[model samples]
Every structure is written in structure tokens, then in C-alpha cells.
Target: MDAMTSKGKPSPRSSVRPLSNEQVARLGERHNLVDVTRYYPNGPRMPDAPEIGAQNPRATARLLEGVSIVMRQRSRVKAWGYDRVPTNGPFIVACTHVAMYDVFIPMMSIFHQGRRPRFMAKAEMATWPLIGRWFQLVGMQPVERGSGKALAIESESIRILASGRPLTLWPEGTLTRDPQKWPMSLKPGVGIIALEASRRLGREVPLHCSATWGAASINQWWPWPRRNVVSCFDDRLPYGDLLKDMGAWGDEPPKELVDELVRRVHLRLVALLAEIRGEEPPAEGYWDFRTMTRKPWPQDFDWRIGSSALATETPTDGVIGESGVDPGLNMVDKGAQS
Candidate 1:
């Protein structure tokens, strides 16, 4: 199934075969030949002028400038499909978390393209030394996990969308613990916020899935020859079908529908990352954050039930302690929301 044509259905397991040795070598050659100066002179231009947000102008300018300088000295960043990103109004950006630094790739790309999006990030970031205040100044919505305020956090995210501003989030919540670094099972909060906000606004919120690769190859300590970093802003994922029956379900969306939405997002990210790396993802399955192991696509998994199961059955399953609260419910980290 084409990754971009998911009409509110789960994407089929990938059937694309791995690239051949010669093909892989050719891909590498193309990246190595890229001229950073050509693309680095200015950020990718958007077809429509960017819709500015409520961020502090000076702070946003300085933050973008500082990030651009550091990225230029470290790696060459190239992006595609800027035209696919919506030029105006409220939308959601669900990006893959390959590395901590990869967040800047999308942030800079979007800022340069002409829209300033408010990003969801861990609340602790707001308490950091100097940069903490800077983060809050430049559209960082703090996500306080395990606080029993899952509904409040979701409400805040929906409010941002309702206000007609773009919101970016990393659904995985944390740096991928996936052994191979591919995106893993995503927290369900992204699905919840999107579906809820769309219902409230009387329209389906445009959701875009982005993937970045090659950051893992960089060594932060001793940087020599810069590596090639590439990002793909995929066509807006179609999710209008999910809202067709919204009037029937009162108040909150059903858990099953939310799970399905999360599944589609995960599958799209996998396909996009696969294209970037020119390699096939593991056929076995995606890494489950709670389990810390590879497993096939969950067919009957319920986010709330899964969290409760982990709490009672396997106390030592994953990072979060025995709270048993679903990460989807509370721990959904909007990674590096700048």
C-alpha cells in the first residue's frame, strides 16, 4: 500500500525489499556529492508566506540563528516536500525522533519555510539553567508526564490547535529506545489531541508525518567531515474519515479509534524513514516502548489496558515505574518542542 494513500486505514506491512549493495553504494555517493553551500545559503522557500505565531520575535530569531550556525558546522541538512506542508492555519506535525539533535532539522525547516509552530516538549526542559526560559519564550508547551493530568495536557494541545497555530510533537515521547533507532510504538495522546481538536473545530486537522535520517552517524564529541542529514516532509495524512461518525460518539473518542489512528501514524513514519535510509525496516515488527522488544503490529492492543497489564504482570517491563498509567495517557513526550 502507498504510504501517502492511507484513507484512515492501517497501512499494510511493508513489502519493499532491501536495497542491493550497488544501490546502497550509489545512494551514499549521491549524498556525499551534495554541496551544503547551495542549500545552506537560505532556508527552503515555502510556496505561501509563513503564518507567524505568538512567539517572541527576537527570541525566535536568535534561537533559529544559533541553531542554524551549530547545524551548519556539524552536518549538511537537506529537506524535501516543503510544498506539502500547509502554509496557513492550524495543523499538527508528528516527527520521528532518531536523535536528540534531529529536532532542529524540522524546526529550522518549518521556520525557514514560513510558519512558526508551537511544539510540545517535556516540562522539565522549562526548568533548565538558561535555555529553559528561552525554550518557553519560543513556543515550548511543557508536557508534564505521570502527573495524572493526561486529560489536561490533551486539552492544552487541543486549545493550541483551536487557536489556529501549527503544533509539532514527537509521538514516541522520548528518544527511540528502539535498538536500531527506527520509530517505535507511539503514545496515543497525539491521536487523542488531533481527533478531539478536529471535533471541536468542526474540521479535520491536517496532520503531517516527517522523518529525518543520518544523525546517528554523527559524533558530537569530535566532529570532522560533516555528515549528510536529510528530512522528508510527507504529504498531509488524510484522516477525515475518522471524523465521519464523531457525532455518534459523545465527548471523548473511543479508545479503539484512537489506537487505530496511532497505528497509522507509526506505519507512515516507518515507511518514510525506510525511504530515507534506502533500506527495508525489520520485518519482525516495530519496537514497543513499554516492552523494550520487537513485536508484530498489535491487532487487539488497547492503550489503557496495555498500561494496566504492564503494571500488574511485568513490573520491570520498561522505563516508567509501577505507576501503570499509560504513557499515552500522561507520558506522551512532545520531543524537543522549540
Candidate 2:
């Protein structure tokens, strides 16, 4: 049985519960808004523009300048957790994609924090007018989708991390088609890259997930009364345990391990989004991009549970044995509870 809208069309199920006027107002009070248009140009600048590998320095500067102009004139940006970003070293930032313009929010936020991380974007973005060419010149790794070259992409991502550079990726692969704009199921390549790169470098890579809200409400054409855009960057997600058994698995990590890693990233993004929106995520479940349906949340799973409680007890053969429990939550780490 499916739900129907007043127009007699089937309504898509959503996990997001809408917020009331009072709730939205209360959430609004917590933000410390900065009018980017007024403050950005005069604000403290990064001591020196960190080199972005082989990217064209002049082009990267110009591209960022243009992005700053558009963002400042169109919206106010509020971001936190920059201090949590490692000042130096290799790290991965997986961010949520709510809207097209939202990409710049995290890009600028990371730049402001004085780290110049390369970004993974669709290959088509390299062809966009005005900024497309600049994107390529500014460390954008263009991903060619559905081309049967996933391994190549994954290798390149791992290479970047192994080279001691920061990498930012929108793991959802595209703007979320979630009816409520919540993050959808992520591509497994993010998990694969994180795990493989760590093995190559002999340490767990610092992986962070970030969520942004407010840009979706803005009309890019006639921007005014600048919307309050807020972004939250989480500290490193707990994944050291995932790497402990890597040696036993030989070359390819098990599908179950990769899937569990992806699950953790998805859950973390969902939690961060809930905090930013001040609305609880759909308790019913998360949206599945492939099936275009809402799946039930893992049985007894709580978004507030610490990372340890979220770890999966991955079984061999890449499938969860029937224990009548969600494989993703078969075991809870009592020691890791927050």
C-alpha cells in the first residue's frame, strides 16, 4: 500500500519530519550569522595560500575569488568545527549535497580554515561555463560516472590521500533526490578509498563528515535578505577498528566491511544534518537513491548512539547471517558509548 497526495498521485515516503514554526524559530536563535558580503573581503585571510599540488596557482586564486564574490553577495555563511580539521596531514572530508550551490559552502569553509583540499566532482562539472575550466585548474578531480572505470577513480583518490593531501568528496554522488533533501545512500567508493588508503599509509585516515543547510531555500537569481546558511564539520569518525583486520583479508576488503564503513559515514551525515536543521531525521528510515524508496532504519538504531554502538559485526562471505537483526547493528561496542 502506498500513500497518496490530494491530487491522486502516489506520494513518496520521507523519513524527515517537518519542523513547526516555533521549532524553526528556536533553531534560528542558535546561529551566529555573518553577512559575508560585508565581512568576507575585510576578514582575516589565510596567512599564505597553501599550494594545491599541481593546480594552477593563479587560476585557483581567481576561482576562489569569484566564488567568494558570489557567496558573499548572495548568502550569509556560518560554519563550525574548523578547529577540528587537522592543520597538516592527509584527511578525507565527506560532505552532504543538498543543492547545487551547497558545494561551495564546504569548499569555502575548508579554505577559510587555511587548508587547500582537492575536490572530487563529476566530470561534467569541468565543462560548465564561466567556472568549468577554472574548476579543473583548481584541483578538481573529474569523476566519469557509469563508464566502468570505478577502479581508476578509486585509485586516484587513494593516491591523493597517500600523497599527504586533504581530499573532499560528495559521497552521495549527486544532489540528493531525497524528497526532504536529506543525504541519501552513498557510493561505496568512499569507503573503499578510505580503507585502502589507510592500509597503504599504515594508519587510519582522518575521515570527517559535514552537513550544510539553508542554501536550498535561496533563489540564486535574485538573492536578497541573504539566507542563513550553516555548516557543521564533525571530528574524525571512528573507523580504526575497521582497519585492524585488513591484513587477514588480503587485497580487496570484504564487501561487508566496505558496506559497514559506508553505513557509518551515512549515519554520521544524517546526525550532523539533524543537528544543523534542528529537526529529527525520519525515524522511519533513510532514502535509497537506487531504489527510490524509503528503507526502514536499522532495528533499534539510534542516531545519537556513539560511534562504537554504530560499528557492524561483519561476517564472512559479505552477507549478514540471519540473526533477525540488521547486520549493520548486530553488535554494539559498549566501550565506545559517548
Candidate 3:
């Protein structure tokens, strides 16, 4: 067993030890008791299980739209690319997430464009203090990260898109872990869900790439008289043909197929980041979140976006194999946000 130090801190040897079920249970009543579920059935009972979220999404969408209108006005937010968004049908809006507060940017932008956005958000949001219920009422689908419920989330997401509402998902899943905060490698679930949605609809669901910068200012707790721009790139993906071409439309998509789809999305995200920064990006590669060690943000107040050194880093092998790992669907380490 690993030892603890005199200061109540873990010893160096105790840093990353694995625990048995019995040992884990003995650590605390919360861990030891399953009887707590009798009182709080949905409250962290079987904490590792995947939760699919509340039923009845359309009703929630209605309430969320009303709430976002007030938030939009207060934030003084603006959006570019109304022409780029689809006006008549169901579509997928894939965006880069830099800050949790910035989720409002996409919410307001899409709302003003005449569509309600159904987000595939973290399951914890359903139980967050004040806004947890609001999240459920907004038709946000909750997902337990890394519980192997990605396919469950994808199924629900496809249903939301089929309903003709714009479904917004952060392909990065979490904030950019890049030292420079440029867009990182995207999770493949967005591509997979878009493909599946298009297959169900008998046509391609347009995938719009959105990049939101300046939202980082909100993290400093002084958001505004300053501006936050939500830029929706003009490039839209015809996912149906792309999927068929890559052989992803079959009963089971191969690992290479999904990787290629994610790669295509990553390239476009990099281009969008370059456009937002008003500078040229690295010639061939970007920082891979799976393998890169992220740098912490500055301690003082600074509104500038973080970025990485322009090095040609290749994606690490074995980081994600045929069974694609959805890091966004995996555990969230909120340290990246700070």
C-alpha cells in the first residue's frame, strides 16, 4: 500500500495507485454504501454508470430559447455567418470550446439564426446547483463521460437532428488543452453522429464549424464592455457522400474511416483558428490533446487568446485505436479551463 506523509498529503509513492473494490468502498460511506440510492436514487449512485439524460427534448428546447434571449442581450454578443447556416432544415453545428461561459455564444448565435440548439452536454450539468434543471429543460442531452455510453449519446443526438433542430456539439469535447489554445484534435463522435443522422434522414446533414474566441475574457470574471465574436465558417460538410466515400456508412465503420473523418474536421478547425487569429497556422500539424502536455493559463488578467508553438507534431500512435476513444465523452479535468 502507498503511504501518506505527515502533512495529510499523499506521499510521492501514493500518487497513482490502483484500488480494489473493497478498498475503494472502505474509504468513505459514500463509496461503501449502495443504500444511499434509496434516498437519492439519481444522486451519484453507481457514479461510473452512463446516464442518457431526461426524456422529452422538444419541450426543453422551448424553455431554453426563452432563457438564452435574455443572456444574449446581457452579454452583448454578436455572430457572423448567418448566410452560412442552413435556414430550412436540420443540421449539425460543430464548434471549438475554449471556456464554459462561451457556450452561451453559440447558444445565442444559433437562436438568433432562427434555430434552437440541442447540446450533448456533460451529465453533471443535469445536477449542477442552480442551472442543472435549466439545462434539462433546455433539451440538453446529458452524458456521463467515459462510461462507454458514447453510442447512446450518438443515438439521441441523431434523433435530435432528425427532429430538424440544430444540434450543437463541441468536437473538442472540452476546452483546448493546447499551450497556445489553438484548436486541438477533434473527437470522432461528431463525424459519426453526423453520418448517422444523414443516413436516417436520407440526405446529408450539414456540419458547420464554429470558432469562438474572446470568451476567455469571461473566465477572468470581467466579460464585458469587450467583444466576443462567434465566427461560423463558410465551409459546410456534405457528410453523406463523405461517409459513403470513406466506407463509414456500412453496418460498422472501420477505425481508419472514423480517424479520417476526425482528421478532416481537425484540418478545417485549424484553418478556422488561423482565420480567427489573422495569422498563418503551422504547415502540417497541430497539438494533439491525447498526447500533448498542456500549459496553464496566466495568473493575471489578460484577454489575449492562448496559442502553441508552431511545431509539426504527429498524432501519437495507440492514443486512439480502432475502438475510437471519445475524450470528450471521457472524464473531464476542469483544470484545462483555469
Candidate 4:
């Protein structure tokens, strides 16, 4: 979620001036933000935002779980590999963000398996009228995407893990821009969290990758007449073993570790997606955010039944029609993560 001030604007860091250590200290004490000066002087910090499941009692979480159950029923979601979810301890669930409907599918999957999920969501979502309110009630973590709140988000995430709660993250940061709905290049933040959380718990954290396709079929929050197919890759990436291979036990691993960690998860996600599609994944594996230029699947675009004729229509610059499709050359310039 984006960090907002009393004025409901971006935090001061949104300006060119860098944040100070004292400011950082205040954030740490308040928002559960982590101080990682040695790693990144101007790195992201956790925002001092309210989280639903962060410190609340089980009663609230149960209520949210009930909501998930109802949503699953209404959506008629079909999920696979849910039994593979580890029920005994805290684990990381990295998912693909194809459409808005993607959120409900995993929540239902994990909820059906008897676990509540704390999602790392965008900060802006917390400001949306009703959906934002629901997000908080469900204990989703709101994070400012590129306003440099990564460390702070990680701090809160570690706290959640320490509390023995399952946390879900969309490592692609934002909705995928892969026109074909393939996975995008994975971000290293998830790797950082997995590595650090494993160290803090003094045990390896199992990282599970789950991919949901056809969400676009039920896109735009419309659940009727479409069913989502979810695949939970049973093979959990043993982050502990990966750390051991890099000789990073009990200490902060080198920065390079993030790359390897992201690469592994990205590959696994691609493979799982291949299984869902019953075909070999692209030889290139996934699109790299640094170079790829594609538009996100429309939030209201039910690609399963909707025609691309509207999508292909060319429009003038910076104006979207009623369907929210750019209709112009819908290329996205690389910006901050999500």
C-alpha cells in the first residue's frame, strides 16, 4: 500500500530529498519497518499502516476466512494441489497476478486447506472505498510499491512469519503485462524475505509457488459464467538449502543471492503454469520486466469471451474508452516495481 500522510498524499520521501536515519528510526518503531542501512541507505521501509491480521486475534481472521469460503462458493473455483499446502507451519506463497479475480482464487484455495492468508497488497488499494476496507478487514498488508518501503514491508512480513502466519506475495509486483498471460520476471524482494525470514526463525522457510490462469475469464470482478483453474505446485522450494548452497547460514547473505532466488522461483512458476496449460512453457521462460512492453490484462476485460477487436483498435494518446482498454500502442515503460 502507498504510504499516505494525514493529507492523504504520498509520503515526503516521494520528493527528491532522501529520508534520514531519525526518520527511519521513527518508522521502525511505528510501522514495524526494518532498518537496513548497511544494505541500502535509501532502501524502502515498512509504512506505518494498519494491518488486519498483523496483531489481531484469531476471531477476526476466522471472519475473513468465512468470507473467503462464501466467495469460493459463489465463484465455483476449481483448484488443484491444495492438499500440498503445508498446514503445520508458516510458509511463503508466491502467486501470479493475472487479473483482479486472481486474488480470490488463492484465498479460497488456502482457506479451503484450513489456513488464513495475509497478502502483501498495494498501498493504493487501501484507499479504495469498499474494496480497500475489505482488504484491511482480511488482513492484507498494504505496501507502497516504489516509494521505497521494501525493507519496512519485509520487517512486517518477518513479524507475520514469526507469528506463525502464512503470507502471500505477488512477486511480479503489479498485475502481469504478459499479453499471453505468461509469468513475468520475478522480483528479488520475495527472495529477500524468504532468506531473511528463514534466518530469523533459525530454520529453512518453505517457499511454495502457485499459479492461477483463466482468471481473466472472470475478470472485472464478475464471477458468474466463468470458473478459475488454480494449480498449487506441490514442490516447495527449500529456501534453506538454497541458502546453504550459498554459505549464508545464520548471517545476511550477499546481495547476489536475490538474483538466484528470484530465478529459481520464476522458473518454478513457469513450469507450474506449463502444467496448467498442458504444454511446454516458452523457451525464454518468462518476460523480463526490464525489456518487455505489454499491457496488463484489463481489470474489466473478460478475455475468455471478450473479443480483442476492441483491444486492437488504435486510439489517440492517453485516453481510454469505456472498457479501459488503451486502444493505442499500449506499451508500458519500465517504472518502479508494481
lDDT of each: 0.67, 0.68, 0.51, 0.55
lDDT of 2 by residue, 77-159 (tens): 66665545565677899999887666787777665554578888888889998888888877789887754667888889999
lDDT of 4 by residue, 1-338 (tens): 23222211211212212223343343235332221111111222221112322434344445444555555554444444554555446778888876665666666556434445688888788898755776776667888766567678878988888777778988887766555566776667788788777677766666777776544554334445434344443345554445555443435555677666776676666655654544454443356565674324324423232222322234323211111222343222111111
Off by over 4 Å in 2: 1-54, 305-338
Where does model 4 exceed 4 Å of error? 1-75, 219-224, 245-251, 293-338
| Model 1, span 100-171: residue lDDT tens | 665778877776555678898878889989788988887889877764666777788899999888899888
Worst 10 residues of 3 by lDDT: 1-10
For model 3, how does the per-residue alpha-carbon lDDT over 1-338 read when each residue is reduced to its tens digit?
Answer: 00100111112212212222343233233222221101111121111111112323344344445555544543433334433444445677777766664466665455433344678787877998977887766557787676466677777888888876668888876666654556666777887787767667666666766765544543244434533433443346433435555344467455565665565566566665554544554433465665564333224312122211111222222111111223344332212111
What is the TM-score (0 to 1) of candidate 1? 0.75
Q: Which candidate is the best by TM-score?
A: 2
Q: What is the lDDT of residue 115 in candidate 3?
A: 41
The parts of candidate 1 lying over 4 Å away from their true place are 1-53, 298-338
TM-score rank order: 2, 1, 4, 3
Per-residue error at 66 for model 2, in Å? Answer: 1.7
Better of 3 and 4 by TM-score: 4
TM-score of predicted structure 4: 0.63
Best by lDDT: 2
Candidate 4 lDDT for residue 47: 16
lDDT of 1: 0.67
